[model samples]
Target chain A: MRLARLPWWAIIIVAGLAIVFYSFFTSPLYRRALIFVTDDPRLTTTRFANVIYDVRTDEGGIRRVEGVFVGQRGDILNVETSRQVTIRVPRADIAALSCEPPASEGDCPVDATITLLRAQISGFLIFEDMGRFRIVTDDGERQEVRKFDVIIDAVQRTPENCPPSPEARCRVVLPLNPEREANQLSGTVLEANADDFLIELAPEVIVPVRQSDIVAVVRYTPAECALNNLVGCDSGIFLTLFVAVIAFALAVVIGLVAGLMRISDNPILYNAATVYVEVLRGVPLLVTLLFVNFALYVWLRDEFPKIAPTLQLIIAALALIVALSQAWSKRALLKSEPSSFWQPIVAAAIMGTTLVAVTGLFAANSDLPPLSRGILGLAICYGAYLAELFRAGIQSIGRGQMEAARSLGMSYLQAMRYIILPQAFRVVLPPLGNEFIAMLKDTALLTVIALPEMTQRARIFAADTFRVFEPYITIGALYLCMTLLLSVLVRAAERRLALPR
Target chain B: MAETPIILVQNVSKHFRTPRGVVHALRNVSLEVYPREVITIIGPSGSGKSTLLRCINRLETFDSGAIIVDGIALDTAANINRVRAEVGMVFQSFNLFPNYTALENICLAQRVVRKRSRKEAIEIARALLAKVGIPEKADAYPGQLSGGQQQRVAIARALAMQPKIMLFDEPTSALDPEMIKEVLDVMLQLAAEGMTMLVVSHEMGFARAAASRAIFMDQGEIVEQGDPQTLFTAPQSERMKIFLSKIIKH
Candidate 1:
């Protein structure tokens, strides 16, 4: 039995779907596996005896604790302090827990702090004295009690040094008795209010104090999260569309100049136009774009301060105009009267100047609302190519037609306008349509300067989700669909304008 | 007798630039054509016949001479187009605008050079086409018509301008042997109506039947000049004798 062959795009789609399905299924599995393996008791028990881990406190100004677990139950543990004090807890007495990897794994050992403020430890704790406490664990039939020595790691001399208000993960150092010694106690504030602060004393112990006793206060600010979001969401689209519009506008101007110059009888104008076209056409579009944005923009910024961002637009317009005008002017100049050389150039100049001035004014005034740059850029770029097409179409008419017109007392201009241009324009329609289609595709270049076009929006979406592939794929599809639609429109126009055989 | 002639030539000479230095196409030649007189010029190839005819309309300027056509001198640029409009020309190739129909081709000169209204030009073109006996073919493009028909259209196009004098440059040369008769007949009819025409042709029968005056040219100079009947029967120059005998024998 033979299987049906899938189209390439279908294959790509299937592969993409498979990848998505696999990733979707595997994501949760990976997360669960990560949690379970890291929390495994086999590693924690072995590493917990020799290594003392500290969960820094907020009140003692991020003090480090050193302890070892000696006794264990479902929710209870006996932890021996660095001075050999063992603390025990009942099954339901533990409030919080965390795990860390062993030191030998090239990473610091995990330190976990458990706060017992919410737990009902009063039922299970044995108070030996004012400064000592113990915990009892019930192991079903037997009660295992562990007793160990107790000593103050460091006695705080002045309790007034603690911070008044504590934020998340903030620490405060307190001097319990400054008259007696210079000893200090470090504690992380577990909770805080305007008048009172709660801090973790040990793994499960928490102490509270009034804010009036404290002498210091500190605040930690969270990292600004909106900047990255803004850059990704807003700036990306804005810059791209901006650049594309500028480039397109420049292209139109270049087309007009080169088109008119090509037809000019003056060697200076014609040669300059030819050179411009040659240079632009020879260079890669990416190179030209970069050169305009980086080099030309920098050079012209001082001289033309009013048109800074629009410098790229100017350069793009100039480059495209040069390329397009050269081709058009050459074709037009060869076939048309010398006076006609000004038509495309004048039209393009007007369009370019108007577009540039408007865009510059808007850009200066902070009114680049949306997609205006992209539209302008596309118009400019395509206009140049169109002018050339017009020239070529005009030239395609036979010389006999011109001579006939002249013989009838029609001046050269009259003959070209009435007899030659009409026929030539019919011939040029197909190629002109092609140029328009190209222009539509080239609009994607707008992303460089942060215009909020479709592609830029997609990028922002991707960055937010940290899933880079999907958004780009979707964007690519959107662009392709748009370009295809434009191509279809151009083809329809070409057909409508096509001359009958 | 002292009054200026309708057309006057004073020692008119023409030289052409060529790769082999200046060619003396016409040399100190002079002639006058009165109003409404049919003048036929007969010459062998390279005898300055067509050049002389073109000079009369100022289409070909002479190097050193004065040609006064209908009262205005040909030397001035100011009167060139005006002169051309008055002295309409029919080319050997029938240089009609191929893109236009016969009627449009005829009407264009009338409307453009003469500044006539389109309606008036069209009416004049139609009448002229009828005069040439090809009114039915007025709507046909030049390319669609035969050589004889196109030549007749060319004649009609020139006449539409309402020129006083018509210069024919070997009008029948490019036509077929049978088609030549049609164009010659039109010329003969024009001549009988006392139209001032300068025609360069080798058609002996046309000269004899329609030409009031026949001038024979050899070596860029007039070899003999007289009435067509007298010129054909007895020539003054040996060159004319040889040329006429050769033509008649053929």
Candidate 2:
């Protein structure tokens, strides 16, 4: 009786959650750890944390030491070694600190504040805080993000061996298949726009490729792309799978209900379903996500920042509550020894985690998490398509079923429930399963909104490691595994429910 | 037979708009069936036999004409369902709800339309199953049943509705030769029990034994109609002779 009453998988899930929380919240780096760097993290020292230093000793050889950063005493910088021993460094002897160029006196204050803030958060990289670049001149640093054109124009480097002014010597790459080599033009870039691109391959020879034709603007060197690369946090496949499953679940419910409405006799219901299907179908998913994630999200934040995130949090919290409680319910959770006592705390923790995630979403100036935007976008889009599939499935049932039901006095809705949909579902299951696999792949599109799903997350790792092939190969295998697994599941379901011969 | 007709048809014509052209399936057909009349309709393919049967229950609406079943006029979509409920139909392909057990097939409409409780519906289903001589197969799905058994289940499903009239559109035509007997036996029992029925079948034996009247149709029109014995023995239209000679040889 006790065994039967015990909730299945509840203990395992709870234990898993506990381990995850421990690994994440404690000092141990959970899979992917985010680290952010300021423009020049040089001479300025504020909040002391671990730092690697290249120090020139009196013997004239450089020595590397890991130590805590201490504030500068005049021209001599103070430092504490890992051995608890204090050390002093004159400005001339201090060769390098944290791989950053020496910051001017004016830059030190901002750098100090950033370093202090970073230390306070235990070195976690909030997406918004990451990759923030600002131009700092001797006069006074402008308090704004550097635009692309400005950076391209101003930062011509002597070491890069490029022309001192204006045109950038770059390698322009065009999209190419594996069968062909990548089309690259090593030339001086003259001008580029949405429509046209002009590159001077040689002084006399100018090659023009359409912007639409270009695959990528290859950087001078394969270096760290902070926007696309990260060392650790999550392989982030779960984010993709989670959003896909949730969106698909939502889509199924919406599809079936709305699909029935389309064929229903009532004009209001029929017209409403028809309009929903037509409008949603017409609007491209990419456009919808972009609008919802950026424009819509920004407007909401600007107009009602407090209310927007609050309302979002409430919705997220309630959803989490429902989901977690349902999952935990198998344990007879509230009725169990720890439950009634531990329930509120667990509930709070769930809410807190979700809230943190939501906050992080906006922290990147993305307004909402890319996953949230992806889910809504995919669900609505797929729901429209599925509605059509469902309509066709329902129609495929023999007219005699309806006739049989109607002749026996069953109303249209009743006939559908009892006789029609069950048959339609049987016919539709295979296609619906195919749609699910398709949806799993489509989750990759959510990366446009910058969700750190597999493709987006792997690209981030690839940019960081400068190993494009390995990350891309891993991504391909992951997607293949997911789709294959989904196919197998669908087949198994079909087999289990196969009609007797 | 009752003085008042239980099923009435007057100048019913139906045309289907196909991609090729509009095909007139039923042309100015007129027929009346009194209470407890077992009328058998036999015709070549595309002769409007099944189309006419469908028209009675308003499953296939006539382009023009009037069909009154159980005194209710099948004139408007609003009243069509009510009229349909009084007329039960069995199809050539059985058209049994594939996902449901034979028992559930019988009970579904009874519970939904008649507001019968689960227990009452089950009881009615079981009784109809027994009447159809397949009570043991009540729990079996249509897919699991033989063609003959499926047709019987379809009959039982219709019977459970307690409809005033039953229409069968070539019920045994899709069945194997050996399976035809089981379905015909159930129809014979229904005819003996005096259920008003309209059947379209090629089986002249069943027509002669059970039908009060036999109708011969060709080119979307009734070629001839009479008592089955007279219709079969006496010479009438050329179409009737050709149809009967073709069917009766078997």
Candidate 3:
């Protein structure tokens, strides 16, 4: 084709490239090559574009500029006066053109220093010397100016320096189920620290409070400069994403194991799977959910707290190590030399012990609300469904495939890893896509346990505004769009898989 | 006869315990296949021809029998993987892993089972694909290939492991009549290269042209055994004669 007959898109792209090239060459990073350094003061007034900077002769002095420039010639400054005369001044007579004056003005007699309180101070402040403060004024100057000069423009208030007395009555809230008659501790603010404070109900009863109690400390009597700010409704998305991500990731692994157990030849595996399916799969998801949130999780945090979960992690580590070694070891357990085989085992034992020991150091009350407990509960619930999906996908593969793999001397795990599972994944793609959508919706149920997901977040807004129609409609549309996006992704994957290798 | 048998099947019998009754798939089926010998078993369906071949690779478990392949006793040891590694089997349906490319199907078993490095496995797979005369189809998925091409890939997949013996259970039976020749031709090439093979098929021409020994089976038992020339031209048993006559009529 002739260059003039090129496609519209090609012409457009070439035009865009030319524009980009011009912009790139003219950019500030390449300014040295393009920009002319001028000291000519009279060049300020121009038909040709130029910059005029008004600079202070001395520090703390104002410099100003005048007029939309009319014209300039041969370094002569034509100043357009407000009275209408275009006053011309010779460039030789002008001093210097600059943006700002050099430095701070005269010092305050050597003994004066200041702590600048520029913006509004947030939260409470402890015992700090409040003298000779430097601040940024509305006029946009950072200086240690006279305080009495600004006192007329500010609300002068008396300062309270004394700590709250032991007899000072207050209410304390702990981290627990808000519905239950728990977490409410009535006390007095005894003393304050950098992060937390000591509170006392009576003279001899004092309790140390940690910041993560997510507390709001109130005084019985108001102070001189008391501040109360309303922090808005936040059903944080990070918290929701955290729960969904952990739940889904764990569920996939759990599903794989349970599905394998169902297909295993051992009677123990078969019986274990039967029990898992009958009890967890048969029971209502709500029952297990509530029980974990209200009962078990509470007990772990409040009663036997640290011991139970730490022990479980230790056991989990041990089981994982054992399973990995048994499945993938290159050497036969009996035939291999002890030093070669036992090294990994010893290392794993040491690691597991260290894990247990590390967990012991922190008296971590799983202060996690149902937000986290719901993650655990949901993973267990969905894992069962995914297992059945996995089993169906696995079983649908031709028996000849397994025979072919095994005839190649591959172990059961090897065959499953290399051959069977990869094929099964292809077969189960549409169903797995559906499961992801189901999982996204299931996260909404977490709100029943008082954890906020998207629906719960919208509900809060709806409740506050008393406008159900708009919020729900907006949320429904958002959810449908998200699901449609997921569908698009799944369809793309299907199309990719359908392509010839 | 001086060289040890590549495959020795002794008194092998297998029965299926279906809901209806115990259907005997194999009954006292014994045979020896020597090194570089190509043996073909011809019979009608349900005559234990496929069962007897599958037993050598322990793909089917026998009720009472012994199958020794490459000096490793099958079913008598915990690790049948050793026996499996030396003996490769190709199926009638091709049984190529649908997820993998023709080259990947060949490379997978070599990497996973034989523990060949990726580069080494790919090199061998490409060679085998070339040997099967579809060198350009190395990157094509099994689903993208024709029946003959897919079967050739399956044969190459089996060959990639460098098995001591190759089992073909009606390899050409599932192919289109036109496509059957391509698969049979590859098998004939493998035979010419002195690969020990045991095939079960009703392809009289393949049996006559390629096989060193021919066996006839019926009612889950071997009815007649001899050279391809002796069996095809002059049958010994009444069942063999009737089976040949029926096949010839078709």
Candidate 4:
């Protein structure tokens, strides 16, 4: 009903966000991109592709080459261009090769031009005809502008000499062609090295320059090259959603079962559920998450096999029997209670999944991936809270309903399934929605385990860019959008499910 | 009538443990109802009349002795459901499931416990609704119906199982003055049709008209019992006289 008062624009915005979130979460391409962005750079084998080389020549100029690194010979580094031609450069000439996208400010480069020395005028630099010296510009007026001419140990540019664009970095005078004399033939520098380099004097006319130029090579890769292309932070949003949804689902199941056990008359089940609720709820979610990720997983990995075989057999047998019995019982009521027919199947599936997960613990050589461990921790912690919700919901029904149900010859389980649980489900739905939204927001805590969820991605981005407010604010907004979308959906569902008053 | 008793309650004693102390709810209560015979039990609050009816279907477990409904013993846990199926009960508050319609309330037990087909259950439910004189109210929920109509629906829900014996625990006590007759009329009709019944109520006029035997209970024990004609006219015990005076005078 509160949603009814919302303006049309607000509704449209929420709906649009819902569609966008749904599309991103469902798209495999997006998922793969997210993986590429979020995966550890050191472990990724594809990080070397699409490399840009900054080679310093014997002349004190830096030449930018965009290429893939082919195999290297004794002292020659083979760099293949987009046109499939491999250029061999001495290893000493290659100043730096970077695969990361350019970040803001200092680490990136500004434009410059280079002037060749007169020493190699005729013998090797025959392309520069009748010139005492040739000058080459590294900025891409002659080609696509994709390279950054990184300058090191250069004079800082003042505000008066800044470029037309006038950025914070534009203040520095580029070190590429630092000096331009009275008579020098300026060409387009294509590729350069310490031995011999190519310079384009005109269109389609490239010639080589020899090592004996009147310049010295001096350049170093910047100390702090930020991996500031934080597109991967978007992947973190999807990851958080995935963790929240899966953990919420797992928590619901755990809560339902544990809630039933808590209310049941059987002492063992009751006490076990009581202990689980007390212990899980008493501990902080972060502590539980960390313990599960760091401590519990290690213990489970080592000790799981010892108990798996026997527990596996017992559970398997129990699952089979429960499935068979439920099927047998449901056959008669199938026409009347069609939905109830799925109860046994769901029960069997839960049991089967538990068995598989336990066995997987034995089969796995290492702890579960951080994402899975985080999800597990979230599920366990939230399950206790949800169990309390379920218990309160169940208990909210009066004693007379149970008595009336029982008086009709219905078994305890039958009464609960047909009568109590349906009502309880309705009662608990609103709180369940709240819990889901809470869990979605709580996924931010999983950053400690390095789960690569949205918050984690944002943290990494913040750390990399050294800008705290931007990443955190962006991630916070994303979380709010998701939670709002979820709230609207839940409200819609509640309205639909509301009993005829 | 020398026919076999449909329900036999023998020395059934029950107690409830409270934070205060153990309260004896039923102290060695015993009774029997022959087929087609209607018995009415009158008692004060906590006199064990409702507990006796509840124990008949094993809703309330007895501390001592045994209960047999239509020859099935209540001592065994396995027989509880079977025994319940054979014995139907109506509560004072008319506990018709709020989630269900009048028809669904009647059909639920039949389709579930009786393993009747949905169509069969619906058919039976419709007939019972008609029999209870509220055929038009079948689709209505308990909340939509009046107190008298709800109680009638509760009766129909119990009868949907085609139980051999019916128990009523102060069925008309919760109804308003203007509504009590509708429910009593239904019970009287059931009595006329010879459905074996054991009702606990202070409705003396209905008891006098429909009951074959009348019982008076006090302090968790049956004080007096006889044919309704003699019991209503002249009670034997001092406790029965005092209880009859307290209820009848008002």
Instruction: Return the lDDT, model 3, position A171.
Output: 15
lDDT tens per residue, model 4, B1-250: 6888888888888899999999998888888879999999998898888888888886776778888788888754457778888888999999888778899999998988889999999998899899999999989988799999999999999999888889999999999999999999999999999999999998999999999999888878888999988987788888887877887775
Fnat per model, in the order shown:
0.09, 0.62, 0.59, 0.47
DockQ result, candidate 3:
0.44
Top DockQ hit: 3
The best candidate by TM-score is 4
Shift of residue A470 alpha carbon in model 3, Å: 2.8
Query: After superposition, which runs of candidate 2 have C-alpha atoms over 4 Å from their true positions?
Result: A1-235, A246-388, A467-485, B19-22, B76-79
Q: Write the per-residue lDDT of candidate 4 for residues A1-501, one digit (tens) a residue.
A: 588998999888777656645644675323333333344322222113334556667666867654544334455544445432222222233233221234332122212123333211111110111222122122211111111222223423445444322012232222332233411333444564444344444432122223333133332121111244222223466567778899999999899888876876445457778999999999999999989998988887777667677777776776676567667766754543344566656756675678667676655644576777898999999999999999999899988888989889897788988888887778889889999999999999998988777778776765643556545555555777778878979988788766654
Better of 2 and 4 by TM-score: 4
Error of 4 at A348 (Å): 16
- Chain B TM-score list for all models: 0.96, 0.96, 0.96, 0.96
Ranking, DockQ, top scorer first: 3, 4, 2, 1
**Pairwise DockQ winner, candidates 2 and 4:** 4
Residue pairs with backbone overlap in model 3? A300-A305
The DockQ-derived docking category for candidate 2 is acceptable
Q: Rate the local accuracy (lDDT) of all candidates.
A: 0.59, 0.66, 0.64, 0.71
Cα RMSD, model 2 = 21.9
- DockQ for every model comes to 0.07, 0.23, 0.44, 0.26
Tens digits of lDDT, candidate 2, A223-291: 122223221123266566777899999899779867876876445457778999999889987787777
What does candidate 1's lDDT look like per residue over A93-136, in tens digits? Answer: 32332223222321122132322222222222322235333332
Tens digits of per-residue lDDT for model 1, B30-138: 8888877788899889999989987887556677878877888765444554566677778888877655689988887677667899999999888988988899997
**In candidate 1 chain A, what residue range of length 10 has the lowest lDDT sum?**
A166-175
Name the lDDT value of residue A266 in candidate 2: 41
In model 4, where do residues sit more than 4 Å from their true spots? Answer: A1-4, A7-175, A178-234, A266-268, A295-366, A466-469, B16-22, B75-80, B229-233
lDDT of 3 by residue, A1-501 (tens): 476987898677557545544643554212211111111112122222122335233454534433323344444434333322111111221122111122233211111221111212112121112332233222222233232323323422223333311111211111122222211222333433343223343432112222233122221221111012111112434344557678888888778767766765445455676678667788777787888788977676666554657575866676465545634562444331233345445544654565466455323646665656898888888888888888888899889888888777776667788888887888778777777777776777777787766667666655643445544544454455557678768887877766364
